[model samples]
Structures are given as C-alpha cells and as structure tokens.
Target: MDFRDHLRKIIHVDMDAFYASVEQLDDPSLKGKALAVGGSSKRGVVAAASYEARKYGVKSAMSGRQAARLCPHLIFVRPRFERYKEISQQIRKIFFEYTDLVEPLSLDEAYLDVTVNKFNFPSATILAREIREKIKAKTGLNASAGISINKFIAKVASDINKPNGQKTIPPEDVIDFLEQLDIRKFYGVGKVTQDKMYRLGIFTGADLKLKTLDYLQEHFGKSGLHYYNVVRGIHLSEVKTTRIRKSLGAERTFSENISSEIYMLEKLEDIAEEVERRLKNSRVAGKTITLKLKYSDFSVQTRSKTLKLFIASKALIMEETKALLYQEPIKDSIRLLGISLSNLNTEQPKSVKKPSIPKEEQLKLPF
Candidate 1:
C-alpha cells in the first residue's frame, strides 16, 4: 500500500478581499463597486482591493496614486483594523469547531489539519464547505477554501477559484495537479527566483521534475531539494497548532526615493517607534532588530543585529535601528524603510517542521 494514502488532510482557508469586503458589507452603498482600503495620500499604499478593483489592475502594495491611474473611479477608504479583527475572531471560532490544528498565516488566511476532525467526517472537502457557509452566515463575507494532503498544495489550490470558491486535490491527483501548475504560481518562487528558473528552462512543475536532485541542489542549495520534493508532491511539514510570534515589523513606502541620510534616519525613527508600540501591545520582547531598505530600483536589503538581551523600549529600538542604518553608507535613493523585532521569547512549536525555504523567503501569496 502507498504510505502516502495515510497522509493528513489539510485545508487552507482565505477570506476574499477581506478589508474591502467588510467595507462593502457594512455599507450597502459600496456594493458592486470598485473599492480599495488604505490611505489615499500621495505616499499611501493599498492594503486591500476588492475584486471589482482587481479587474482594473488594482492590487495591494500599489501606491494610491498608481491605483488612481489604473482605476479612474476607484474608491479608497481607510482600513478599520479593529473591525476586521473582530470578524476574524468570529470566523476562527467556527474553525475551532472542526479542528484544533489551525495555523493562521494572517488575519485573512489560515491552515487547518482535518485528517481527523471533531465532526468525524472522512471528507475534508465537506468540512471546508460547511465552514465556509458558517463564515458567510455569521460574518456576511465570502471565504475560499482548498483541501489537499499538505499545506503547500492546499494553500495554492485555494487560489484556483477565489472570491467565494473552493477546490480539492485528491491524494491520487496531487502529482498531476502539480505537473500542470505554472512555475510562477509555485508558493515560494518570487520574481528573482522565477527569473532564475526561467533562465534554467524550468517553467512548470513538469520542467522542474526533469532536473536531477544534484543539479537542483547545486543551483539552489537546500531550497533546491525543497523544490525537487514539492514538484514530486512530497512535503512533510505538519500543520502547527501552536505558533510562535516570529517578528513584529512595520514599513512605509515613499512617494519618491530619498537619498539624504538625515531624511532616511528620520523615517527609520518613525518606523522604530511604531514597531516598539506593537511589541509592547503584544507583550513580547525581542533581541533581534532588523532594518529593511528598499531601493528605488526595487532591490531590497536587510540588516540585522541580535542583542544579548531582549528590549522592547522605543528608545532602544530606535537606537539599534539607527546604528544598523548608519553602519553602511547609503548606496542609492531608498523608496521604503522598515523596522522589525524577532528572536522573540515564545518558543517554536516542536510539532511543526520548518520549511526548507524559511518563512522570510516565502512571498505572501497574491490570493
């Protein structure tokens, strides 16, 4: 018997344009209209965009000015995070009714291991549907779900039919499903990696499967082996029920890149203060301070220092961020600045195995 048949059933659930949807829900006047939730200021970036806006090429992380140019009639609303958080809690309560093996990736997306569920259903597909219905009934928002043998496939599958949809990849179909997937659609493949893969003639899972394991390893290091296994539909990572807080960070993209050290340091101080406030609110302290700089050319660089003691004070965080910022001379005009705290006090759960491509390496799925 194929031992793979015994794999745990996993489900990935994602809310549909959560913030924008909520705005539409609470105010019926906004229904069926293109909407984006975020500051509409010159330097503001979109936090979320509704499906209607998406049709016009609006997207999250796009600057408000660019979004306006893309969708002439796009409506911008400031985010109400507290309201979104309240709805998230309501949906999570429904998830817990089915399984305790829930790992939340963000306020809008989560993974659940339902191989053995509270309802005693053998079909994860059914559970996913019922949970989505419950969410809609309780929150008046649409959610999409994907059921598969592992988190990776399930998460990717969730995007297949988005905005109130679901898809399931049976165990027997895993290999074929992946073979047909586009290289750009793979979970951890960013623009840089995608371009590299294109150069290597790996454009699909089928193409990736043609390379030798040694060849992959030689090219991509440990992550190469990871890609090899994923293409073959083999991932051993488990759904983590208890997750540690990895980092607390905030970033701001500017309307125009700034090259002046004085201006850059001023922005860093603002980011550091926000990060400090969030750390205190969460009651977590960290020893590592990271400074993220995004250049005008779109290239990104991060500098980090792990201190001997955990500190959550704004003064200390700013002090460290400034040190890291000044340690290296400004190379180019910077378009963004961010500050983060990591190496937190919470312990990593032993039940879940870390992926070969670290969480930091994985790009947030567009879905």
Candidate 2:
C-alpha cells in the first residue's frame, strides 16, 4: 500500500529530557552536569534525568539512592512544574501556527497532522524541520521528530534519532521498517510482552507476521489482532485533538504509614477535597468512587462502589469513600491512599472507522 495515496502525514515531536533540559537552560552552571530532578530525599523517586546522568545509567523512576549509587556527583533539584507548563504552552503556540491538528501527549511530546497544513506544503519532512527550528529559536531547546504515515510509527521513529535529530519513514518503506524493527522497540511492547513474544519466537515484525490470527489471539488475546495489523502497516488510530478523561483521581504518599483506620480518616478528607477541586475544574461528575491503598510493603488494594446518581460535591464523595474504606478491614499499614471517580458524565469516545482500502491492496516494496 502506498500510504502517500491513502494515509495522513503524521509527525511526532518530543522534547529532549524536558525537565532536566529546562533546569539546565535556566541555570547555565548545571549544563553538561549529571542532573536529576525531584529525587533527593530518602523516599524520593527521580522524575527526570539529564543526558549526562543517563550516560551513567540513571533514569527516570529510579530510586534516589540507586541514582546516587549510579552517579555519585549527580545534582538533585526540585521540579518547577509551573515553569514547565509555561514553556509547554509557548511550544504549543508554535505548533498552532502550522496546523490545528496537534495532539499533545504530554508537556514534552505531541503528534501533529500536517497533511493539510497552513502553508499547504506537500512535504511533511520540511514542515517538521521548520517546526523544530522554530521551537529551538523560541525555547533554546533541542527536539527530535519522527515523520511517517501514522502516529504509532512516528512515535517509535522519534526515539530512533534522539536529542536533536529526526527520522522520516516514507509510506513506501513503512513495511520494511516495521518488519526489521526490534520487538522490544515497538511502541507498546513492554518488557513482559517482549519476553512473551521472545518465548513464542516473535523477535521482530517479520517474526510476528508469521503468526496466524487464531494462534495470536489464543496466546495474547485482543492484542494479537493489533500486532497482526501493525506489522502489515495498517494502523487506524487518529491523532486526537481532545482526549477523553475516563477517570479523575487524587492520591498522597505519606512519609509514615498508618496502621489504624481512624488515623486514615483525616488524610482521606484532604484527598476528597482535592478530588472535588479537580471535578469542579473539569465541570464533571461521576457515579463510581474507588478507594486505593498501597501497603507499607508496596502491595496495593482497591475497593469501589457505584452510586445511583452522579455526584461531585466533597461531602458526597467523602461519604461514599468512607463507606468503602470502612467496608473492608485494613490488612496492613497503609503508606499511600487515593480516591478516583469514574463513569463520568463527560463525553464517551467513539471508535475510529478504518480506511476504505480494498482487500487486493499490497504494501509497496522499497526495492
């Protein structure tokens, strides 16, 4: 299939180590130094790591103690989330100049559909280069981009050339590209899935393509169909401009674990207030209240109850959560407590329809 004939021009742009880069940009002294953000305390977890720290095998989500062991001189700094959001908004304004079909994945990454851009430019490649240049001039930061016929391939390719590079996989080469891709490197293949694929001799896209639909479904369930299609260069997901929030939640990890339910009530009240604030901001309500607890040993437990009517007030939310919390006996000291509301009144998502390609179509060979 010639994606040029039927596919959208998608570009995935990602900021390089966003939080660490911003910190370095603000403090010149931190530039070229091993840096980690928000991971100094004994119980703290690293939110982001700079390239220099990464060279020492430091990574986001690593424990502060472990990161310190990896890179002894790594500098730890608090995260200034407001500043990051300020810069993210500025970057998005630049995206709007080219196309309104921008889907932000996070503060540092987004998917842009430039098939019909403001400039009417036929080459999405040129647009990507220009966008990155504009972002560099505006933020003094480097970004990487992946240009392709779909969001999944674009997201994967963006990571191929990191920091300040970009990779473009044209429609004609997509099949070959996916075929040669490492199973671990596929966009959604996590370690557990990768290991499973390895056991099944599905080490590459080509390997995966050999598996029959029935065999895959029996082994991997619903994900089997997705793997079968993606390897054939047939992804139907669109770049959504607005994502639906299925659930809203607030949680806190306490410095000390509480062994008594009575001691947890006050903490639950504070969390309920936060959840109410978030609900008020979103102007939405839900019928389900779920209470999540993480034990001192890192195990987790959740209890949920669905109400007859959607409720958003803190009083009602707390009342429902308290009932669920007290319904079950506390088995262990709780280190974390969370409350989430689902079955929201917000608009539900509609499935995207597949393209009108005939069954006789074949992927264009790069040779």
Candidate 3:
C-alpha cells in the first residue's frame, strides 16, 4: 500500500504506568498504593511511579529523596527488566497477530500501522479496541490506544484517555486538534524547548502555526521545520518494522559527590566492566567510547574518542577511559559517571543523542 494511504490507519499503544503497574500486578497487595519503582536510596531515581504517587508529584526521573519528600508514605520497589521483557514479548505477540507494521518506541509503547490488518477490519478504531482488550485479558494489565491519521497525532492522542481507554482523531479533526494542543503537550517539546517557545510567544499549536518555516529553522535548527509541519498535520513518517540499537550505556549517581580523581578511577573501572558485559551480550563492538560525567551542580561533561578498530574487552575499554579521564583536569566534584559504546558493527547504526525529524520523503501533506 502507498505510504500516504498507510498514514491514515496508525495506532499508538501505550501501557499504563508500565513498570509500577507490573510490580503491582505481580504483588496485588501493593495495588492501590502510591508506589515508586526503583531504589529507595538517596541517589536513586524513580524509574516509574504509580498513578497514586503521581497525584503526590512523585514521578519518574525524580530523585528518590525528592520523591520521599513529596510523599512520605511512598513505597519503593526494585525493577525487574527480564520479567518486564517477558511480558512485553507476550504483548507484542498479540500485536503481530494483527499487523507486522509495528514500531516499538519502548517496551511499553509502540506505533502500529493497521492500514491492512490480518482480520481485514475496516475501522482502525475497532481494531485498536480489540488489541487493548486482548492485552488486558492476556496480561491482566491495562493498555491505552490512540487512533489517528498519522503517527505523531496518534502518539499525542494516546495520552488523552489513558489507562485502559482509547481516543481516535479522524482525518477531518486532525487540523483543529493540532491547533488546540498546548505547546507543552506537542509531544516533541521538552522543557528546554518549551521555555524557548514561551519566549517566542508560541503558547499553543495555533501560536506555533503563525511562525514562518524559515523563522523556526533559524531558532530551533532543523527541529523548527518539524514544529511547522506537525502543527499543520503534515508528519510523513511511517512505522518501521525493526528498530536498531544505537548505543549501549549505563550510568550511576553516587550517594555523595566525590572530588578525588583516585576515587573516580575506581568508579570508572566498575562502569567499564558493565559496558563490556553489555557489549558481549549484544554481540557487537564499537570504536567510539564516550565517558560522561555529571558534576555536583548537575552540569554534565562528556569526552569521546573513536579508535582505529572496534574493541569490546573490559581491559581495552578501561585503558581508553583512563587516558580520557586524565586527558583533561576535572575542575569540579562529580555526582554521576557513565560509559557508552557507539559506532557499532551493526551496519550503519545511528546514535540516539538527539531527536531529529525522520528522513522519509517529505511533501506538502494536505490537512
């Protein structure tokens, strides 16, 4: 089918409070409580928060300490990735039964092109309903869906009626929907971008739609063009069947900031060993090594070097990291350190450092 025709039947499926919900599902005793899934230590960040905790302003990415301050009664639980992946696979199996044009944004969310589904269903909304029902029955968990003419709108709509609900934005309503959307809820607008938009007096999609494409590009770089197009219901990207691994990385924030270089080396060794183990599991190696350091004040510094050839050994990774560490003097105390491998042998891999508009064929899409 033509890509344009396929655009009209996309559905974005997202699990509700995935990690916390899974934890609650496995232990029903924990079900109605305000839960934060991750370590309870001062340095730990909440990976996910239950709906109850969200009402208390405890959310994912907030420090456990802050989460505790927000809700003194918040319960903490460690994450189980293997178990989540197991259930995710089962949920995906249900998706494959309907369509193969499934693009997973993460384990808990995906975009599916149901333009031509297995059951030959005429209405994508009905298909999305059935898919969510199947997920609920099979996993005893709730899944939300948004059906729209394009992926971006579907993704945004998915969040409107969440936790076992669905929303559909038909083709005729796409333009008005985008225009009425808050600039903050435009899907791609981050806090930084939102601040920039506020400065530009662009508070809503209607406000964004007023700016010229060239003006946006001058301000937002290439992302400006994206803002212009999406507000006009012109996203031409398609759901991919496969997603490539861009980079493998792990980071840890210390309970207390450290200033001594000697202590930093000890932490680097442990992080490099972890990178090696992950590289081996993925069965891929890379030449580019990036060492990330987050200072006590939350400012971040990154150093990277690409080798003549890819190497995966912990010894080699550590050897390179040690040289990079001393390459420049670190002026401030650090609270977090991380290591990652990129430029993999996985045939033209792209790093996930920034969000760029898809490079698919772009044309003036009629709203």
Candidate 4:
C-alpha cells in the first residue's frame, strides 16, 4: 500500500461573519440587521459584512459608499481587532485541549491536526461536533468546521455548512467528493485561472483529472503539479504549530496630501520608526527595505533595496527608506507613506526543505 494513502485527519474551523457577528452579540440591538464592520468614509472598504447585509449583495472589501447604496439601512461599525484577538485566543485554548497542532489562518479561522488528538476520539467527525459545541458555550459564537485528510479539502469543506455547521469528507469518499466538486471550488484557482480552465473545457474536478501531468505542466507551469495532486486528494502538507513572519511593515495615510519632498521625508521618518518598533517587538531583522508611496490620484509606487546583512534599527531603516525616496522624482502629491522589511533571518521548519524556491514562490499560507 502507498504510505500516502494513510494521511492524518485535519479540521478547518471558521467563525461565521466573525466581526459582524461579534458586533451583534455584544449589542443585541444590531442582531438580525444588516451590519458592516469597517470605516464608513469615502475611501473606506468593508472589512466584514453581516449575513443580513450579504443578502443585499453587500460584500467585504466593497466600498462603504457602494454598500450604503446597496442597503440603505446598513449599519456600519468600527472594527475592534483587540477584542477579536482576545476571543481568538480563547478559541485557541479550546483547540489546545484537543491538539497542539493548530495553524491559525486568522482571528476567525484555523486548521487543526486531530489525527493524534489528546481526547483520543475515534471519529474526527464526533470530535468536530464537540469542538463546535465547546466554542459556542465558551465564546457565545457560531463556528463552522470542515474535516478531511488534508488542509485544502478541510478548508473547502468548512464553507459547505457555514455559520454554525460542520462537514466531513472521509478518506474513502475523497475521490468522489472532489469529482463532483466544481473547478471553481479548487483552492488557489482564482477567477482568471477558472476562466482559462473553462475555456480549456476543465469545468470540474473530474475534468481536471482527465489531463496528463505533462500537459498541465506545459500550460500552467509549477502550479500544474499542485493541481494534479490536489485533484487526486493527495495534499501532503501538515498542520503547522508555529507560524513564521516573513515580513514586517507599517503605513500611514495623511490628512492632507504632501507636495514637498522635504515634508515627505519627514513623514517617511515616522513610518520607518513604526516599522522599526514592530521589528524589534518581533525580535527579527530583514535584508530588504521597501518604500511605498500612494499619490493623491490613488496610484501607488514602491521601491526596494536589499542589503548583504539583516537590519532592524530605526536609523538603518530610515536611512535605507530615505535613499529609496530620493531615487525618483515625486510625480504627484503623495497621500500615503510606508515602509516594509522582508528576507527575514528566520526559517520555518518544513517537512520537506525547499531552499532553492524563491521566497515569493512559497504559497502564502492565509494568516
């Protein structure tokens, strides 16, 4: 038998309309109403929308103005990240009671490895139900969970029964489950790729499985290999316990657009200082410094420089970012200034080490 056939069980847990739901829970009057958690300004985007708002075609990342136009009675609430983080920590504590192998995708979602759970449950499905119940009792919130053999399927399954529900795909059912699934549901396949797949007659997992690996590689390059394995329900990635920080940065939007280069330099100094503080708190350093500028017209530009050594000090970050600032002329009055550091001096423990892969090539684990 292939060793890959005996994979560990994984569960993906996601909160339902997390921010908006929290708002409703804290203030019962907002319950059963269209609510959005984000800025209500002209430039503000919806960070999260309640299920009620979603029914009106309001979605997260939509402009607040557009959301208002869609639902005239939509209620906008500011995001309280600190409060969300506190609740997330509580949820994590519950997960730790079952297993230490938990990968947090965000404050609202996480992946758990329950193949060797502390509770010694024989069925992952039963354990998922218990976890959901515990979450409701402890946090007074609804959570949906998806259980499968790997992260991708588990994550996708979690969405099937959302807002206080759960779904499971046993090992024997993996193949059939994927075959009936639409190609658009595949993880990492975005809108553009979905359209191209449609044009190529690959409309479902069954259709995707019909293509040869060589043919897929020829057309889709490296991602073709990922698709082939995923279609076969063969994702071997483990549930990671620790997350590595790949970059640290901060930015600020000014009340008034700055036209003078001298004033812009002053703003850059403050942003660079904030980046330095974050780097120190993380106890990490990076070799690349990127300077970002957004103009009044909403066009953005970024310049970066890589050094032979890692740096995290304010003086060095400011010096490097300032050097990038003067490299080009200010085309338009700048509205935002920011700086970021990448190429960190830390490496995540991997089941398979891929040192040759470019840092940018690594799949951004949702966090």
Per-model CA lDDT versus the true structure: 0.86, 0.87, 0.87, 0.86
Model 1 clashing residue pairs (backbone) = none
lDDT for model 3:
0.87
| lDDT for each residue of candidate 1 in 198-280, tens digit (9 for 90 to 100) | 99999999999899999999998888988988888777778887777888889988878899989988887788788888998
lDDT of 3 by residue, 119-152 (tens): 8776888899999999999999999999987899
Q: What is the C-alpha RMSD of each candidate to the true structure, in Å?
A: 6.3, 3.3, 5.2, 6.4
User: Tens digit of lDDT per residue, candidate 4, span 1-367?
Assistant: 2214546678999999999999999999999999989846454668999999999998997767789999989999989999999999999999999988889988999999877679776578888899999999999999999998789999999999987999998776788999989999999899999999999999999999999999889878999988988999888777777788888999876766789989988887888889888898999999999999889877889999999999999899988987898898889998778899999998767652211323352222111
Q: Evaluated with lDDT, which candidate comes out highest?
A: 2
lDDT of 4 at 88: 92
Per-model TM against the reference: 0.87, 0.90, 0.90, 0.88
| CA shift of 269, model 4, Å | 3.1
| Model with the higher lDDT, candidate 1 or 4 | 1
Ranking by TM-score: 2, 3, 4, 1
Worst 10 residues of 1 by lDDT: 358-367
Indicate the residue-level lDDT of 175 in model 1: 85
- Residue-level error in angstroms, candidate 2, position 262: 2.6
For model 2, what is the alpha-carbon lDDT of residue 349?
67
Q: Clash number for model 3? A: 0
Q: How many angstroms is residue 333 displaced in model 2 relative to the true structure, after the best TM-score fit?
A: 2.6
